[model samples]
Target: MSARRRSISFALFGAALGFATIATGPAKGFDFNIFVDPEDNYIDASAFLARGGFIPVPVIITEPAVDGGFGIIGQFVRTPEHPGDQPPRTMIGIAKTGNGSTAGGILRSGNMRDGSVRYKYGFGAADMTMPIFPFGLDQSVDYHNKNLAGFANMRMRLGESDFWTGPRLIYRQTDVSLGEDADLGPVASRVRDQINNLFDSKQYIALGASLHYDTRNNPLSPTDGINGVLRLDFYDDAFGSDADFRVGQGALASFTPFGEDWSLGILSKYKWTNGDNPFFTLPSVDLRGVQSGRYSGDAAYSTEVELRRQFTPRWAGVVFGGYGESFVSHTKLYDAEGDIWAYGAGVRYKLARKIGLDVGLDLAKGPEESIFYIQFGHAWGRDMD
Candidate 1:
């Protein structure tokens, strides 16, 4: 072939390669959510209720400052809730002081998304030397430490919609402590410290790839419009495991109807662990059922589903229920083996674009007893993707 012909052929080959990569590369999906609370209204209400719920009397509290101080009661009150229409992306609240007075404040979050790559980083800390009244107890303590954390995630899409593929990466860390005057039992205090560190000092790194249909949308909403997500998570350092590994799978689907005024969603998640789960990386509510970390000889699993309905542009509701089970050869918390089933319902009101307010009540049944959970948001996928 002539030199000019050969150059043209080479150019064609390069174009084909580029096209193939674009068609086979992972599809880019992201969670880029943002929220701004103009005032402390929501947090204040949550705190008042948390305090009232714990104790028989109403405990009046003050607003926390925006410094390094914190107010536990106030923070708990200001914590945000999930609504069926949107995702849970951020939190804002006041810090507390040991004197039951306001000290500093806090802001925490991890949310972002752009084309084929998405990332999230969350971190916040506070030392509220404040007083606390444990429900049903008359004693109040004057010391507490706020915990902080952050994580990042990224993904690249694969092939066409007919057969999809991608990879994910994540990292997380946290710390917590009690006030000065209060004295906690050795076990309880240690437990508290451990819980605090779960999201504080510890770092959990994860890497995994997923495959799905081009037609299905990952379950970002409580309702599926004929699309869903089937994801598998593998860990290189599942909670500092490094060489130790664990895996988790999650399925989310949803549907909409009646001119988008109503919808329903379902989520089923299962996780299995091998190796002893790291000492500090078990699983807990703070991590929202996501696989955290573990060592050899340890294993755990969980499954859940949610239903939601939209009544109006500004009004909607959701119901979610699930079961969680776990086991370990030797862990102070899981030695006996246990399972928990939970069910709840909530309502939402959209106050702005992709921003809304939510209130919900959940009842959880376990091997030990029945517990109630009350808070905000629809609690499904949170801030629908």
Candidate 2:
């Protein structure tokens, strides 16, 4: 389906959940929240979950944002198969970021940490940046792109093995357009002359496999344990792709506790993409402080750390900082690099103690600007492990 159609589909799907539970009370296994003008100027009606357990959640938001608008989201977690069954855990969700991003997904896991399966369908704008010619010219063309994708994945725990391996397939269509403020005279002609297939929009497919491991007790807000992943995927003309390419991705996260109420957390990611791939698919830099994606080269790495101390029954304090580097090509990492750094601190409130969920906010400074995030969970993505 077209990217726009998929986005609308996910939005409608999430709304169905909202309609069913709107008149239902909290006793009916539903949780909802409303936040007005939270940073991005949107009235957010949401159903979110933390470590709090299985409950249906729905979220609606009115965003008075720049290049962003209204949206809805729905999410929940439950036991695999049925609520009465035991062991394996599962989560299903659909959401629209209001910045024109939308998606729906389901993930299942083995209680014994033996395996997992994930399926997703999505559409809308991708937070991507480019450093290549024609597409990356700051003075020439500010870029905007929308992507539609469907993905399926499965992983099995190797018998008595600590590692998990799985196969995955991805299909996507992307459309790139020039920003309104673009200037054509200065460098547009040169871009046109140098580029051959960078601007074309088309459908593509990728098939590959992944290996991962995680130990964090609660990856969302890890108080202890570790999380790591290694994955490689390939796409070629044989798969109806406009380009032929391969990508490798990896991440590692660890959390440790000290004393009674203190803990340390660290997260990191690295990516290497090459071949006839689209610019937006390249590795880029994103963390705190950096709002727009700016660095998309052949390789990139980013890392962040946080220190936390629970000071009260329902509150906690934290401080954090991180930096990133992007290389023009997939080198050994340290050799070809452009650095971007950011750091900040924030506080948290235990919104739902049963789930170990804390809702909070943060203000941080990046190399070029500063930003604030109304955090729902950890600012980064980590495996459930």
Candidate 3:
């Protein structure tokens, strides 16, 4: 069987075992009502989860670039210590895709110093087969990669304001090669050699700083206010990197409520890279419809907008559209050939009322194909980054 199929089977088995254990285990005053919404008479897990429940979250991969797959994540959460505080979380997950891509990781996120400081850290490893179309080539080549990576970030609030700044660090080691079954087709021998040389195994370490501002009414389901970030990163031999480069990125999102039932969201982002860098580290046009890395270059920018209508207390609907462009240089962005557009619609169900968290599905149509995504919380959020 394919690795992804095996992963799904194992996830199913684990889910069944988890349910069995919960069914037979002790329940001191625990009742099924904890999983029900008292006001709407609908099924909900907000209360149970808030009370430090352990849940198994299913991972479904529908990215056309990855050929789709499934897996699972096991999560444990601790309730916040005070009102309006974020709950601390710990998670471990593993997944595989039809294209022989596999990944596994463990992550933790929480607040410290009484919410003055926020911290996140994670470690992960992946083996993937990725398609790349270089220099506006119409055809793509498959690149196989094995990587191990880790990152940490800590941000402290700026006194009493809604601003935060911090330092971040990332380390990764990767080995890359042309896929064994890749079809070179009409690609030239010189181009093939160049691609091979650009993908040699290397270790990379980067140090960065970030500035953030957030004034959202609710992070899980923001109906008002703005959130934004600016970041700069340096990767150099002094930091144990095999390549020296610098990257700068910025993003901003705003939410405005039109009434009790309507809300509008807009998000914009831009990224640029300078100095010698690996091909895999280049920026790409990140939009719902575009496959990851499908439109990458030295610089890229994208803007997306979403309109949401709350149909009922428990359900909402949304329509979104976006445009993006990738270019070799800032001066050539206007004339870039890698420009594209996409649009889609989706529905959401309020899964956790207290936390204002919603679960949903989206169907987007990009330049090449239509793809569906299973989403939790805001699709564009970076809270756990």
Candidate 4:
């Protein structure tokens, strides 16, 4: 979808959600969730399985904690079938500063500590965010260890709202591990220059801005809504000059039809890469695709349409199918344009007013994959921005 189209779609989606929340008694409070995704056996070598969610509690400390509230969240998940194995446990400490910027504070798993500050000056016309953190916190499972790692993410926006069209600038540095065990190791091990490469060598710094419009229903408890996000990116490698700072763009559209006893939605994604690109920042959902960063060096797109109708207020049935293809640059990949598709049905169960749990079995290309998806904060593909 074009940026204009995506913006319009998002606006409509947000509006729907807002209307739902206002119409429905305005539910509130914490949410605990868990879900499993299993597509690891795909030949593309990109899929995997995992599950976890936040702890539901009254720890939220801000009004509409859904938006700018802060609290502690704990959860865990596993890959069981990945190249490396380790059941990771996570504990996140969150603190919100305000609503002017999309920034906050985070202390995760003890190894990663980050602080973010966001502010808007000049009558909220200009906005800025600074995120600073130290890595290598998760590498040590035994003793509390320290390592050489640090990076910063900075963005400046000149827009009245977070979703307004504007120019943005970002800078990041990822590879610089010290005193930490090599990835998949406990202590004294090789150092990974970048974090993503620590597990699989893929790292890069991306800088870009986009023009967008977003309108969606209830920021929370959205059963029916719509959203669209469009972005353009320029990526530069901190390690070497592999790609000429590849330029890429992503377009997405999603919507849930209103008032249907059954659910119907459409999600579309399109991404294009310029040159030899780093694998980490590919515009694809992890474990949701056949390959991780599978469409890095070329152009690719995918679209899925789903219809879900509820038999009971707590139970709903859903059916979905879609196709996607990626090429190593339109010309070189001639016969290499890989295609993927899946179709399936599932049951959704709602818990409390803010959470929905779904279990499904999808046939990917031919093989059956089981998936348990969860809904939190907002519906899938919907962003506050």
The number of the candidate with the highest TM-score is 3
Q: Candidate 3 vs candidate 4: which has greater lDDT?
A: 3
Instruction: Rank by lDDT, highest first.
Output: 3, 2, 1, 4
Inter-residue clash pairs, candidate 3: none
lDDT of 2 by residue, 12-127 (tens): 22243432332232323333333221333222232233232444444332221222233334344432332211223355655554444544545444433322333333333343
Model 1 regions lying over 4 Å from their true place: 1-116, 124-149, 159-222, 226-262, 284-297, 309-313, 329-333, 336-339, 353-377, 382-385
TM-score for each model: 0.46, 0.69, 0.87, 0.46
Weakest ten-residue segment in model 2 by summed lDDT = 4-13
lDDT of 3 at 54: 80
What TM-score, to 2 decimals, does candidate 1 have?
0.46
Model 4 bad stretches (over 4 Å): 1-163, 166-203, 220-223, 236-243, 256-260, 279-297, 330-335, 352-379, 382-385
Clash totals, every prediction: 65, 8, 0, 24
On residues 1-385, what C-alpha lDDT tens digit does candidate 4 reach at each position?
Answer: 0111111011111121232332243233212111111222111111111334333222232221112233333332222232211122242322332432222222222111121112111100111111111121212121111111122222232354334443444333223222234454532242333542443322344556565444444323344555555666666555332344555454554556657585566767676666554332333321231322223334667677777777765445666676766554343322333456655554443322222222222222211233333232222433223
lDDT of 1 by residue, 1-385 (tens): 0000000001111121232332232213212111212242111122222232221111112112111222222222222232221122333334333343332223233222322222333344433333332221334433343323333333344422344455555443323345432467888777776655553444446666655442323222223354334544555553463445555544443454544565555544443455434433343321122211211113445455655677754446666666655555544433423345556565544322233333333444433334343333334432122
Tell me each candidate's RMSD, in Å, in order: 18.7, 8.3, 5.7, 17.1
Candidate 1: lDDT over CA atoms? 0.36
Error of 3 at 14 (Å): 17
By lDDT, the best candidate is: 3
Task: Give the higher-TM-score candidate: 1 or 3.
Answer: 3
Candidate 1 lDDT at 10 equals 10
